[model samples]
Target chain A: MNLGLDRNTIYPATHMWRRFSYFFFAIFFCFAIAANLLAQDWIKSGTGLGVERIRIAVPEFKAANQDPRNSELLRTFNDTLWNDLTNAGIFEMVSKSFYPLGQIGAPSDVKFDTWGQTPVNAAMLVFGNLGASGNNVVVQGWLEDVKNPNSPPVLAKQYTDNATTQQARVIAHKFADEIIFRLGGGINGIAETQIYYVSTRSGHKEIWAMDYDGANQHPVTTLGTISLSPHVSPDGSRLAFSSFNGSAWEIRMFSFDLNRMVSFPRYGRTNLSPSWAPDGTRLAFSSSRSGTPEIYAVDQSGGNLHRLTNSGTTNVSPTWNRKTGSEIAWVSRHGDLPKIFTMSADGTNVQQLTDQGYAVSPSWSPNGQFLVFSWMRHYGPGAPGSQDIYLMDVTNKQWVQLTHDGGRNDFPCWSPDNRHIVFQSNRSGSLQIWSMLADGSNQKQLTTSGTNSEPDWSWK
Target chain B: MKQSQSRWIALVFALGAILFLGACHKKAAPAPPPPPPPPPTPTATLTANPETIDKGQSTTLTWQTSNATDISIEGVGAVQPNGTQQVTPTESTTYTLTAKGAGGTQTATARVTVNAPPPPPPPPPPSLTEEQLFAQNVKDVYFDYDKSDVRADQQSLVQADAAFLQQHPNMSVTIEGHCDERGSTEYNLALGDNRASAVKNALVAAGVPADRVKTVSFGKEKPFCTESNEACWQQNRRGHFVLNK
Candidate 1:
């Protein structure tokens, strides 16, 4: 019997040695490739495209038809406009310190060379004029494309509001939005928005409101009971939230126009986290009417009731797309741990968004493309858990950690523009409301005094 | 040299025979494992003193177990190896004693039943108002952090509550639920109501009617424990029973 290869099929030992060497070379090649990938920079932006923030210059508006009130009103308006641009997270405004020592308040008044110089180097410009009439103030704003001199102005807007400090500031916010919209290629800015958060400064957990920039902080609900999770309707006509009235957690809708709660006491269940539908005709909230906490869809008038999820575990924090109205994102405790999950409106399809650990407080983006939520991975007793906000792409399970070892971040809600996220983090000593760019940059604390949490942005 | 070669060959043949025998022995099946030792015997004793109770009246159950690491009775939770518990069963229930240890589990049985009481000649004059009488026996039930389950220790209190509610069938109750100041106010609202609902269910199971009790959650708005500590938080997580006028 032949124990070796046939003579015609003789193979060289060198061939076998070569094959062994080839296997080793393949392993080394894989290591080299992996090293290259590991050396690449971590992309903090959730989007793959590394887009640069636009460069814009906002010069102080010239005092047109100067009255004694014009000076202060002009100051208020100009300063507000500047802040709106800065907080947008889409623009890098040329600081007033870097200005060319000129007050250009109109498209024709803008000298391109002054703005084109080393300090400003602006590709876009926002110049405006403000003045006072009898009982109202007039404001005219012009946005210019500094890079393309042949093109017409990017935007031109005018406002006539009562001659009050708030009206002046509001006018500035509008002009700033015009510049942002034109630059952002039609995505509206959140300058004129409001953030409703739970602040304990009033000695009770009350619903409070503040401007997007954290000004005009005032209590919205004076229930003297614990009220939380304020969700504004898309048209800004109603505010939906949950209040604990010593009996049960009931979903309460406060009509802004009526300045009182609309009587819809049909629900007598443990209801919480009431979210408004995009059409403003219905609402989605978690209610325990069926023995266990489940997500339910109800008409705003508490009719057409529908149960959306039956996950059996505690379902909570339901947020709608408010863009297409096709999907709803919420946190559910299925198979033991709480994680983000998405389901159809009619409760047909249920898909878990998170694979492991505790993830909750899911806020669906306006574009219906992403979900921002608080997550603590490997959660257990002594499991070294750090709760942080994470952004996830809905189509794929791809995600980027938005907050790395910040002090216990939770309750992230997306802004109306979808470019920013507001979440509560205890990183700055105490729990406070903080906002950051949707890509996880430009994280700025919004509330400084008292314990603040669960911030919900208003509709544009 | 011829003799030496012959001896070497014989020695080699002899060693080869031993090798052949060893290889043949390898084909035989492996040895079987020894049988496990018999489970240790355990003894459990359970008894109800009165062995009967009225619809909402309380009865005492005493239990004793030997060689047991943990012990519990049917419907009641984990208990001491030798201890007594007061139970108020709405119906005739067979109390099963389960004792577990390293050796094995052993069980015993006791029964408590609802039976009609003998008629008395006369009744004493009313001492307290219906509201005052109900309030005298029924008290608030507390809960653990982030949990809404009624602990076994609170079973007696809940039973007394059911008894009072049953005695005054027309009286109504408001179960105001509350939570500690740790979690989100919105989630805490649900947690607080869960506690209230758990208590209401317990009372209903113990012979009290469901419609007589309504539950509300105040979340962390009305905390019994004001300080931000574990002790205070424990005090705050409660379902306070309030009589409705």
Candidate 2:
């Protein structure tokens, strides 16, 4: 048989070797190229899952006053808003060079195409008139969504009564929430909320109320007596607190609008930790009038006194879970650690929800699925001084640590949406109101004055 | 030549046969001894007594195990016999003993009773001292923040403190002013000082001599009760007298 160089014929050994080498080389080259493409595809698909990269353009804030240079208040407000939005994890803010519009409230109209050419998906225009109003500085501005310039921008107004140039940063935080609510799909604006806390600037414990961002702080009671446990009504209209009237601890009510005060029945004993019921018609408080510290419910008119707890183990801090209209949360000393216990408003079906350390001061979320409380672990002496805030899921019985580094953080109050909690801490070297996301991120200090504590966020 | 070629082919075939057999035998042979019996099976033994212990008291248990084994126990009286073992008892403690070497375990515990302790001796019958029985009852007196000057509203509380001081001329007392846990340590300290001074001044004005009373401000350092509410704060923000005979 003769083998020749025909169309599909095998040739001599030398030619066969050359052909085999070329075929092998082609196959190897294809495999290498395919592997590279496969790797690129996997990376793209992996990163494409809900991971969005967005750039933001924050214009320099223009002050309402015709000051030649930028005011420190304006600068602080601008910086705070920038930090809040960046920490919200929704935007990657672009540099100032990208936004040549100069300042936020600058007179020049925003050029949409200018922001569009850059990678910025949204441009925040925060231009406000900051001027003194009575004892406060009012900031009024509108946030425009440059992505869709034709759409109407949202209006945001913040008032910082008793504000110094430094406190303007807190007002800016309120404004930032407004912006987040409008654009970032969070909750309702927190600007109108109030915080009730105990202040001793007057040399005695006085119940004080301030805006959620620590503005417009004012004393609720002027009796010059000892006042503590200032609990805001569910609607944020009235404050139910305990005050010593030179005799015994009495539960008192202070109307925020009328500024009038009324004391509950002079029950020759100490009444403390008044928590307003969801219906706002009754208050649940711990009282020793029953011979021992027990939980009792009093009407808004201080009538119909009903005792809910008879366990006699110093059940204090009774907070009603508005979400579960029938459940009440409190701290029970019946256990070794003051653990969190939940019971029916009628005082049945008691369930212990936590077993981790000494937990106290339980504040339930509006949704009734979780409780935020202070967990303490005393290290050296006296009373186990180390304390931090922890969040527990009532349904799953899971706890997540909210503050780790804040020194002795306690008194955690949840925002209406349960997304953010306002707590008190000496982390910044002084007792101050600080806020963080529910999952323990974006922690920012809200107050800087002498010593502020026991901050209770308003439901409104 | 054809015959010689055939011979050479046979020889080559034989050599190939031998080599293939050798390769097959190598592949099928048993592996070398499996690394020296894998260090011996470390023994760990755990043992305890009474397996159950009562609450509030310490229970000791001994354990012996190989390979430096650690022991642990569980249940109401659950405790670590030593620092190495754990003890937890309130009511009905269960303990588990665990050790190494075949994963051995032996548990013994004593019953733990979480009953309340015996009551203390009763106090003497209530008796009023002659001074307390005859002391004038002053009702009220008030003062400003960090100021000892008597205010108009607190006439009743101050009157009582002063009346008590006046009636007991021979008895000395210490007045302590306290502030709530709300402000700076220094501020509260100063405020407490002012409160005590103000109360003393009021007592002196109400006809009581200043020598009978001493004043000190705890500031916010010491709170009668630690709570964030207004009631606890009210309790902390007051002046108390420690009367001495």
Question: Number of the top candidate by DockQ?
Answer: 1
lDDT agreement with native, every candidate: 0.76, 0.61
Taken in order, the candidates have interface RMSDs of 2.5, 12.2
lDDT, candidate 2, A178-230, per-residue tens: 76555443345465567888887877778888866566788777878777778
TM-score value, chain A, candidate 1: 0.85
Question: Which ranges of candidate 2 are over 4 A from the true structure?
Answer: A1-55, A61-98, A101-108, A117-142, A149-178, A377-385, A428-430, B1-245
Task: State TM-scores per candidate.
Answer: 0.69, 0.54
For each candidate, report its DockQ versus the true two-chain complex. Answer: 0.19, 0.01
Report the error of model 1 at residue A281, Å: 2.3
- As a whole number from 0 to 100, the lDDT of residue A281 in candidate 1 is 83
Candidate 1 residues B61-125, lDDT tens each? Answer: 99889988868775788899999999987667667787766465677878666774557766554
lDDT by residue (tens digit), candidate 1, A379-409? 7657664788887767666666777645789
